[model samples]
Target: MTTSWWTFGLQTVNFLILVWLLSHFFWRPVAAVIERRRQMARDLLDQAQADRDAAAQALEEARRRSAGFEEEREKILAEAWREASEARSAALVQAEAEIATLREQSRTAIAQEEEEAARVWTARAGELALTVAARLAARLDGAAVTETFLRWLTDKIAALPADVRSTLGAAGEVEIVSAAPLEPGLQRRVGAEIGAALGASLSFSYRIEPDLIAGLELRTPHLSVRNSWRADLTQILAEINHDERI
Candidate 1:
């Protein structure tokens, strides 16, 4: 076998040219594409980590806001309860004061009514007594009654002190009031009896008053002697009224 040196050398040169072409075109471009893809993946992973941290911070802030809102609600409720209690106490005090005032007014009104009733009953009793005395006096003998009253007057004057009798006689006139007119003889007798008791001469005046109710009244300027049924009945009624009031 005859070996050709030139042919071997030409083949070696062609292989070297093909190697340069593949390195400059297909190999360099494929390596560049792979490197760019790796860089993009790293950027995406960093962005995902930042997003997770921001989400955790937002959740913590939301929890703090919720706690503050709950505390504010509790404080407002306590204040409202305190205000309501104070208002209730004030209303009760006012109501009690009003009740006390009303009770006092009622007591005063009751006392006044009792006093008025007592006065009315006393007036009625006095009128009834007066009527009964007048009727009894009408049934009696006027002359006999007048004589008895004159005798009583004479006795009363006799019982008086000497100084009192002298004072009564110094009035210059002795008035004799009766329910009916006296006869001239009876009048003269009464005058003599009174003069004997007083130990002095006195001017006499006889007068008729139907209201005397079968009795006599001897009057002086500063002294009077009443011996009459009407006057006795009035005194009794006054005593009874005073006792009832007590």
Candidate 2:
């Protein structure tokens, strides 16, 4: 078919108009919408990345803060424990100091009491010595004082001291014991009794007091009894004188 020139021209014009219409109206608006959507997606992705970074930073900061809090709590607990221990130690020291003070006070009191007692005892002893010396001066001297006093002393000693008189018998024996002219039986009797009482054996001496008018005299360290006629006669004469006076 032979195409007409005018139809071809019209068809070309229509094709051109369609392309222009698509480019200007449909393609331009569609491309603009697609670009806008792409931009929005990119911005959302950037925001998500920023949020993730912020979360990671916050988490690290929270962990550091938690660790610092734990360390502080432990330090506080340790300080409290140390303070309690110091308080206990101070209390114990005070208690020991009080005990030491009490002990010293008690020791001082006891020492003072003992010293005072010793002083009192010393004064009493001095007074007793003076009294004993005065009595001794009266009885232990003077002449015939020896012979006559010895005679009197011997008889009185046979009766024992007033303190021990009750233990002695009414018929106490008298022996004039002698190492010389000494009889064995005399030694045995005197030694046994005196040994039992005093836990020691007795000693003897020989004596012939030419002054003794008759019977012998018995003697021990602390005792001497005169069993003599002279002693008896003197006593009898005194008794007769007493009867005459009555």
TM-score of 1: 0.58
lDDT of 1 by residue, 59-89 (tens): 7777777777778778877888788777778
How far off is residue 55 in model 2, in Å? 1.1
Cα RMSD, each candidate: 9.2, 16.3
Cα lDDT tens digits for candidate 2, 1-246:
347787888899999999999999999999999999998898888888888889989989999999999999999999989998898899889888888988888888887676556545444543343344334423543233334443444445444665443233222443353212324564454445433433333344445544443344555444555554455555654564456446
Instruction: List the candidates' TM-scores in order.
Output: 0.58, 0.36
In candidate 2 the C-alpha lDDT for residue 90 amounts to: 90
How much is 176 displaced in model 2, in angstroms?
A: 61
Worst 10-residue lDDT window, candidate 1: 1-10
Best prediction by lDDT: 1
